[model samples]
Target: MVRPVTPASAGFRARGALVAVAALVLLAGCSADGEADAGASASPSSSVSAAPSSRPDPDAPLDANQACAAMYVDGGKTLEERIGTALVGASDGLDGTSADQMHAMAMELGRLEPRVPEEFQGPLEKIRVPFLQLQEALDLADGGQVELDIASTVAGLKEYEKLC
Candidate 1:
């Protein structure tokens, strides 16, 4: 007679399988050597050094506005993660309300989305709403609203991962 696995055991096996697959995928898509990965820019003038000889160099460091577009061309890598990290970085200096911080974060995230996956184009579209709410929260300091905004951001992030 064959023994059957329980639900708990099966779930563990499934989780292990997922981890293995993710690892393989990551390994398969390693970024080119000697160049800064899409999310990690070189320095203040990183754009200038990276521009094609035919294209004019950007005057700024990382153009938050152009960030998403870069992500789109980066082969649909960790666009969501890069966006989230960039937002958190922008929010770091703020002492204002959640709305203010999240608004800033969302703007920065928007700048970064063009570089993300094609699938993320629409889901990220909805993120603007929560971001606006976040700005309002900054004025009101609604901690509850802050939590909601983060939840929405995370939800959008989950969509990005699937695109990869």
Candidate 2:
């Protein structure tokens, strides 16, 4: 006879499964074939990523953008040097919310995706509006109501995390 899984147990198992998949995708994206890697840094280009030893630890809990942000410290650069480059190569006509918008944004992400090689596109792709929301929350956080701002950002990020 098959045993039933409690929601708590099932939820934990599901989360573990997601974490494993994210790790695998992260691994597959590495190795840009070197020649391409050397070309960008030598000129004005959008290739962005943290140095390997300096990469944001892929294992940090999803809630900790702070930890990843810290990797940006130390006078170094990230795989996608700018947030726009990190999100999509060209914003061009993109603006605001729409179903197709997210995928459009993600389509441009290929050039920049390997920068944050540890992330699966699933998590990053979900950031379309939530990322905007998080930015608003972070900006608002400076108003001395930091806790509220963080709460808002976390809520948005949780929404993004749901996609993963």
Candidate 3:
């Protein structure tokens, strides 16, 4: 004959099953190299460095204004993030990664400059001076100068964003 389970015993069994499942899930995430495997991949839309080709063509006649705005908006967040990282990295210490990030941002801004609309050209141009200054500071490992340039770049970008 089978014995009747008490309420306490039933609750304990249910908790045991849950704990076992949790352990299996945790273990499944571990790789043989002792690194945890990435479980979920991000979609392209969630990526920061999305392709510029997906944006409208700057030279295209029909929608030049919209194209310019789209181009700027597309890369804005990623550039801002890199700039912030560079600033923080400088403040904390002249970390290699931080300087590298700032360099990358300068390159990206240079690439995007030609796409600026005539109407927005002045503001984008304003940004270049500080951007170059920031890069120079990074190269010389001048944290104080880097901090000042980062602030200037951020302010210019804010105005640029307002245009779009």
**Runs with alpha carbons beyond 4 Å of true place in candidate 1:** 1-52, 56-94, 97-101, 111-118, 126-130, 139-147
Please give the CA lDDT of all the candidate structures.
0.41, 0.31, 0.42
Q: Please, what's the RMSD in Å of model 3?
A: 21.7
Q: Clashes per prediction? A: 15, 9, 0
Q: Candidate 2 versus the native: TM-score? A: 0.21
Q: How do the residues 1-164 of candidate 1 rate in per-residue lDDT, one tens digit apiece?
A: 11111112121122332233234334323432113344444442666656466553433333432443343334444443343433343333334343255566567556644644456666566544445554565567543313223444444444533343
Better of 2 and 3 by TM-score: 3
Question: Which residue pairs show collisions in model 2?
Answer: 48-78, 48-79, 48-80, 48-81, 49-78, 49-79, 49-80, 50-78, 50-79
Between candidates 2 and 3, name the one with more favorable lDDT.
Answer: 3
Candidate 1 local distance difference test against the native: 0.41
User: 9-34, model 3: which lDDT tens digit per residue?
Assistant: 12112233223323332332222112
> What TM-score would each prediction reach against the true structure?
0.38, 0.21, 0.46
Q: Which residue pairs overlap in candidate 3's backbone?
A: none
Candidate 3 deviant stretches above 4 angstroms: 1-77, 137-147
